[model samples]
Target: MARAFNAKVRQREFYPGNLVLRKVLHIALDFRGKFANKYDGPFVVREVFSGEAIILSDMDGTENALPVNADALKKYYP
Candidate 1:
């Protein structure tokens, strides 16, 4: 069974260079659930359009591109 992840309800201010991590709960067409997918790691913020952000994940010799919202993501730092 898939676990339910609470959506981010708070809006936060972000810039172009900000880094973020994809929430384990939020799932999109391009990327599957964080727990279901093989690539489970932090992605770098490439661009922000409106409320969606383009992120790049280089995991397991693959570059996965995903679009997510600020509220659907958490700040990621390594």
Candidate 2:
């Protein structure tokens, strides 16, 4: 099972200063609706870890202490 999963997974890379959209963390905010935005930011990538982790910051420049997995990130072209 693990091999199958690994075979299908592709590595995604992000660089410092690159913009990306992060998956919304649902721990806080009250539920909005089915159509609510499920992702946030065009956040700045602060750093990339050797594995599937990264540090990110919002547009206003606040750095997040938590390291997010690359699976939760999507590249922002603009």
Candidate 3:
């Protein structure tokens, strides 16, 4: 079962200066109302860690307080 799950996993990467969106949790959506977005920001990548963690910056150019797990991020296509 573990092998089957691992096989379905795909690898992704991000680099500093790339734009990405962080996943918004369902609980957060409830407070923001029904139309709230499922993802937040084309937040900038301030740093990347071992290909598994990333530091993101707000759009206004301030770094976030914590490193986000790569699994919580997705590349912003636009």
Q: What lDDT is reached at residue 20 by model 3?
A: 96
**What is the lDDT, from 0 to 100, of the residue 59 in candidate 3?**
84
Number of backbone collisions per candidate, in order?
0, 0, 0
| Candidate 3 local lDDT, 1-78, one digit each (tens) | 999999998879798999999998786337558777889998999988884889999989999989999988899979
Better of 1 and 2 by TM-score: 2
What TM-score quantifies how close candidate 1 is to the native fold? 0.45
- Against the unseen true structure, what C-alpha lDDT does each candidate score? 0.56, 0.90, 0.89
Query: Cα lDDT of model 3 overall?
Result: 0.89
Count: clashes, candidate 2: 0
lDDT of 2 at 57: 95
Q: Which sections of candidate 2 miss by over 4 Å?
A: 1-10, 27-31
Q: After superposition, how far is residue 17 of candidate 3 from its true place, in Å?
A: 0.7
TM-score per candidate: 0.45, 0.75, 0.76
Query: For residues 1-78, what per-residue lDDT tens digits would candidate 1 score against the true structure?
Result: 223333534456655555566655534554433446532456555666774655454433344565666666666676
Please list the residue runs of candidate 3 whose C-alpha ends up more than 4 Å from where it truly belongs after superposition: 1-9, 28-35
TM-score of 2: 0.75
